[model samples]
Target: MEFVMETKNINKYFHKPKEFHVLKNISFGVKKGEFTSIMGKSGSGKSTLLYILSTMDTDYTGQLYLNNDLVTGKSQRELSRIRNKNIGFVFQFHYLLSEFSVLENVMLPAKKLGEKSPAEIERNAQQKLDMLHIGHLAHQRASRISGGEKQRVAIARALINDPTILMGDEPTGNLDSQNSENVFNIFKKLKEEQGLSLLVVTHDEDFAKRTDRIVQLEDGEIIAQ
Candidate 1:
């Protein structure tokens, strides 16, 4: 029953042309080692909710907790450090550095954290790639990889820091069915074998249904969980 992440009375607003309420008092939690999916129609604030949970968006009103630590109202510098150490992100786009080798791309996050020696980071990066079955492409330029391979590389990069939770924003949206299934299998393996907590925002019904739980959002509020 331990929660890895939790949000209490979360509310968000967007002030552009006019002020509009986006997220409405969302109270949610993701348990440790739980694989949860957030699903809804476009503009349901699913992505917005993910941003808040990921600690990338602080303009909301809520109490956010990570690893049982209160993270709300923390300074940006502290939040950044927490995110790098505890949250892994995989977006719809791979976002790999085209010019960098696959190994380098995977190693970039650990290098930024500067918690490990370069030699150790390299070895860890290679192990991540190998775990994903992409170690053979370690020396290849990221631009040379196929779309599916690029996504796998992105997953490897997200895992380099040993994050407490892995969050994905439509991770398989750009992939074909086969590759999408491959990514899901990888996620399942990560959860089953490594006990990694995961929260993903996705429009794919099949993908959402396959997860351990699904939180359904509608009109900026969670309608079902």
Candidate 2:
């Protein structure tokens, strides 16, 4: 089956740190509409692998594919366009602009894409916020909301582009247990209700267990899947 995202013989190195090999022969696939998680302890290359997969770090050896199209060796401009059009990202921190309203934050990606008119983008952004149960907070300043609400707004922003896959790097690391569960449920809802593919890097064992599959990494190598 064609994967939403795939990597082959992927390897990465850190030059300034005395030529340290950060990732080793990593190969994996995230199927369409599948929910997958990557788990490892600190320094295990979990985040490193994620950055490579996300097309944000191109200094690696291997082939990367998104939506069954090879992305390896693409120019930076092409990769940037591909990333913006095909991938939605959420990080451990909700990096929303504090001064922007939640709606504006959610509309930013769609605006950058420039595929839809401003009015249409705003409508779509509001729809995403409503789907995440945060529509009521759309006009609120991002800085004024609770942490949980802000994270939800971040998720809404990620979904605004209607990406091929949603990727997260320890997306719930900053949340309390309840909020973490809420985020997990939101991911689950996206997968079940919208058939959205998701791949997230997380240290939480419980979170990994709940995903359809877990890719376990150790010492820069994929040890299990």
Candidate 3:
């Protein structure tokens, strides 16, 4: 199977009064269209690893392959371009543009990348929103929507770019059990419809169990695959 994202000998460190090693020799692979989760305790560097895999942070020691392309030496400009075209990220806090409506919020990425015309982007955003079953809420301001609905809009936005891999960093961290389940259901919908590869970082056992594989991370390394 083709891998959508992979990391080999990934090591991330931070400098403060003392150097803190956040990720240590992390190596993993996400096959195309598979849903995988990274589970670890707090301060276990799961988020750090996710950011590296998603190409959100570049100052790490490792070889990362996204869609089989080596991403380590990619220029900032080129990395930004790759991230926009090939990757989608969801954070614990749904960072919806409060000023924009749900439809417009989902279209923001395409607009920033100048990937499509306004009318076309809007149409495509609407299509994804509808697929996520949130089309009726498109016109509402992002702040006005419930947490569950906001998460849905965020997922639709992530899908707007038609990315090959979607990475979520504790996407359900802030929601209640009910809302978390709802957010997770959207992931299932995405996997079924698009066969999109998913890499999720979470402490929630229930959410992790829903994925095709659960990887246990301990002390910045993969102890269980």
Candidate No. with top lDDT: 1
Native-referenced Cα lDDT, model 2: 0.94
Better of 1 and 3 by TM-score: 1
Q: What lDDT would candidate 3 get against the real structure?
A: 0.88
lDDT of 3 by residue, 29-88 (tens): 999879999998988888878878877789999899988889998898999989988988
Tens digit per residue, CA lDDT, model 1, 27-115: 98999889999999999999999999999999999899999999999999999999999999999999999999999999999999999
lDDT of 2 by residue, 83-132 (tens): 99899999999999999999999999999889999999999999998988
In model 2, state the lDDT of residue 197: 97
Q: Which ten residues in a row have the lowest lDDT in candidate 1?
A: 25-34
TM-score (C-alpha, index-matched) for candidate 2: 0.98
- Candidate 3 Cα errors over 4 Å, as ranges: none
Error of 3 at 102 (Å): 1.2
Error of 3 at 138 (Å): 1.3
